[model samples]
Structure formats: C-alpha cells, structure tokens
Target: MPLIKNVIHRFHVKRPLTARERELRLDIRKPAGDAPHYQLSLIRLNSTFVECVDKWYAERGFGAMFGAAAFSAVAFGMWVLVTNIFKHWHPIGLFFLLVFPVLLAVTAYIFLCDAFTYTHYPIRFNRKNRQVYAFRPDGTVLKAPWDRVYWTILGHANPLGWLNVAGHVMDESGKTVLETFALSVNSTSKQGEVKLRNHFEFFRLYMQEGPAVALQRIQPVPLIMLPPIDRQKESWAFGWERITLTLNGSPLLQILAQVFFLPESLFRWIVMRTSKIPQWPQWVEDECRIEPDDPWRREPGYRDEEAIAAMQATAGARRNG
Candidate 1:
C-alpha cells in the first residue's frame, strides 16, 4: 500500500513511457459498453470535478496496516541485532547500528504516514478547467492539463493479467511518461480488461462528453447515483470498495471470505480512527466552487433519465434566459 503510493514520485515526470505503459487504447469514441464493471470509486461527480480514491486498493485499511506493521517489526528486529553486537563496543556494529535503524525508521515512517496520516489520496478530474489534480501523500497536489495527459488502459505482466487504467503526464515532446495517476488498477482477470475498458469509458465519456451525453452512451453496469462519501470525515467504510471479493463469484468462497472480513473490518476501523481526512488547498476548493444553477451537478443514486434531463434542462434554461 504505502510502499507503492509513497514512492509514486520515484519515476518522476518527463521520462519516456515504458513498453508496458504504452499498450492498450481506452478510446470510448470507439465503442459503447463492451463490458461494464465499475469498482464504484466515484466519491463525487459534479459540474466541476469527478473525485475518486485509488480503486485498486479501495479496501485500504487492513493491507496498509499490515504493511506498516511488517516494516516496523523488521525495523525493531534489526535494532535488536545491532544492539547485541554493540553492547560490548564492537567497531563493526557502529555502521550497522547507525545505518540499519535509520533506513528502517524511514521505511516505518512512510508506512505509518500512509496508514495513519491521511485517509485517502484522491484523484480529481476537473471538467470545468480541463485539469487533473492528484493529492499526494506529502501534503501537496500534482496538477496537469487534461488534454495533454496520456489516457490509456495499461496491462501488467507481473501481476499476471492485471491491468491499470490511468492517465499519464508526458514530457514536453509528448513521448516520455513523466507522471502517472490511476483511475483503477484492481482488475485482475483477462476479462477484467474489458470491464476496465467499460469502467474507463464511464469517466472518459463524463470528462469528454459531459454527464448528460455520458448517461446516454453508458450501458451494462448502468450509471447511478453512487452515495457521495464525506470528504472531511473518516468512517469505517472510508477505505473500502463497493463490490468486494473477487472469489470467482463462488458462494462458498464468498462465505469463507466473509469469515475473514470480521478481522479485516476491525483493522479498517482502527486505521481510520488513527487517520485524518484529506483537505484540499483552499485555492483548489475556490476553483472547484459550483454555480447556484450548475447543471453538471447531480446527487448520487440519481437515475440516468433524470440525470440527462435535469442537467440538459438546466443548461437549456440558462442558454434560453
């Protein structure tokens, strides 16, 4: 969890795209609903921006806590080893004591920061400004132009059939992969690529064509008002996913998974209690302010017909008036 998110900046911007990152086109202008499977990551989708957490690790708490604990345990063990060697004033222990603890401390800190510091690292796609804003773990936000970003469905070989659908910030010449932020990376099966395609198409359509047009074009999964999450409040479900358990849809496996969910849910609750909700910079919020009659805004769980009709009518009335 923290291992990946904390080091996301390592690749840096202005570098060339990797061969793995270059594959797959997420062109929604190509088709409509090949296989709709959204991970239900939309925190809020209004006139100004569409907000979502990392879909791959939506159920973030337990895994993140485990990661932090693992690092901490190893760090502590290394310190004990260093002390055992140094109590008698061994010269060799000097470097080991100083370096090992320092490295472990830094590792522990990163994981702790991930598990207890912030609730979630949200990626916001602002349609009004045509910009993408990613909230980093280190109290800063990365902003990039929407059109200039390389949007695609990335297939990974290590995770074996796993795919990541995300947007990349390329170098000035538009060839190198400078920065990477994702929509979702949870899809694992080969068929997950198709589901991810449909999922990516949801946002692609929303960003490119607006919610009204997107509502008309989407299918299979059927777009609806996903209950908006509290941006400033942390809850037990804070880092959870909408549809959990990739147990091949087997009832027995799902039941077994549920048996383990008890402990998982407890860890999730513990993580949020120690963590704080993320707060975007005031300037960013100011830019995100909505108009009183903003047509692009709609409540979660709103029907497609109503979504299309409501926003269109509002826009139409404004144009007419």
Candidate 2:
C-alpha cells in the first residue's frame, strides 16, 4: 500500500533527545532494515457514549435549576404587580397558575434534549474492510459498510457532534458509514479514564491490520463548540453520500440536540423522564479556563505583560547591585 506523503510523525512534534535521553525514553536501538510491519494510526480515547449521556443530563439539570429559579423570581415579581392592581381580589394566585405551567414546560424540554440521543463517540477506521465504525459505550457497533462510505474528512476539532454525525454514502456503492456523535475523549476525569480504556480495547480487538502493537503518537485536538455557545459558525464534515444505518432518522438530529441548549432540553425530556440519576457534575474549575500563572512565565505561555515588566525591573535592580 502506498503511504500518504503527509504521514504524521511523533518525532516531528516532540523535542529531540540526546543519546542518553533516547535510551531513557525507549532504549535506543538502530532502525531495523525492514520497514515497520503495520502503518501507525492514532486513536484518541475521550469519553464513552454513556458518560457523555450522563454529562448532558447533568447539564440539563443545572440549566433547569437555573431556569426555574429565574422563572420563579419573575413570577413573584409579576404577582406583586398584580396585587397592586387588585388589592382585594388576590389576582396573584391566578398569575402563579399561568406562570407555573410555562416554567414546567421549559424544564420538561430541557430534560428531553439531554437524555434521548447519542453524542461524543470515537470514530475508527477498519483497514481490512476499508470502512469506519462508531464505537458506542454499550459495545454495540455501528458499522459503516464499504459501499455506503463516502471519503473520510481529515481535520476539524469540535468535540461535540457537528459534522461529526453526518455520513456521506459513496456514489458507486450506495452504502455509507453512518454514525453520529457516539464517543468523546474530551473529559479527563475518572469516568473519562474508563471510556478511554473501552475504546483502547475496542481498537485492539477490531483494528487488526493497522499499525504496531499499540496505537501511538496520539495528541489532543483543541476543543471547539457547536454554535449558539459561541459566535462562531457551526461546523461539520460532509460525506458525499447519505448515511446508511440500521437505525432510521437523520443522525443530524443527534448533533443538533447535543450542541444547542433548546434542542438539548427537548431531547432530554423525551429520553430521560423515566431514568433515575442520569449523570454527575462534569465542569471542573481547572478545565474551565487556561492557567496563566506558572514557574515558566509567571503566566501561561510565558506571556503576561505585567509579569514581563516586573521581571525586567527585578533584572535591572540585580544588575545595579
């Protein structure tokens, strides 16, 4: 098989080590005369479908809690206004009756969107069949038959299900490797570790022909978000053909539900009502923003203007002394 010219090499990004460092890292040895047996492929293990589902539900809870609080405050304000208008009648009771239903509806919608569908899955290439598979957390496989596959898109980095869900079928075969957001590697918590292990096992069992003993040279792609969360436009990788799955309905629906707040709310109500204890808190303070203060620069990336000024002043004083 002809290798692509743009092969991603780990050494390219990693700092080159001296003889001793190389030995320390991997016991330095001369390259074998023969070419490496299998082509190396990178598989990033983030969160499993189950974890993502849980996280989505947790977020829905927060949203509903926040929304409920806001709505209740507003309703109270309205009640006060109506009381002033009709001092003896107590019209505030009627106001509560009207407003409670609307608040309930909003909360219900949030639950549906958060619970019903799949999002954040790891996509794998099956070299033997030359197809793709979206590995779900439950061990159910979404297989992309060769005939259905469109060309695989290379590099877009939003972890949420944007173009991540669309499956383009091949024009000639009429088959598509259709999968929506199923697995994600974004969360690095304990749950995330379990999900990564699941994917690693899946790839080990399934990816027979690709690469060496273990997948290597994995790097984290920076996270991006679906629209309405950011001013940036929504993104996707479009396959040339329509997706084919045993399951009916557009995978795009899953993408929409996971990315935006309103659709997510509706998705949760439909999918999560009967379920108990869906998911737990996902947002850790450390991950919310990049850290700036550090030994390296007194700021992340060594680029704080104030820190630079302070350092310059200290250096000048030291020189005078």
Best by lDDT: 1
The root-mean-square deviation over C-alpha atoms between each candidate and the true structure, in angstroms, is 8.7, 21.2
Q: Evaluate all candidate structures by whole-model CA lDDT and list the values in order.
A: 0.64, 0.32
What is candidate 2's lDDT per residue for 51-90, written digit by digit as tens?
1121121233334335445556666766675666555565
lDDT per residue (tens digit) for residues 1-321 in model 1: 555446632334567776655557555455535544445566676777877776434555556555665777777877687668746777866777677766766666555544565666678888889888887777688899877778776656345554667778777787878777777545666766677777777777777877676655654334554554444444455333332344445878666776556556566666566666777898888877877787767654555675567777777999999
Clashing residue pairs for model 1: 13-178, 14-178, 16-176, 16-177, 17-177, 225-300, 225-301
Off by over 4 Å in 1: 1-5, 8-14, 27-38, 68-113, 155-162, 218-228, 232-234, 237-250, 299-321
Residue 242 deviation, candidate 2, in Å?
Answer: 33
Q: Give the TM-score of candidate 1.
A: 0.71
Alpha-carbon lDDT of model 2: 0.32
Clash number for model 2? Answer: 34
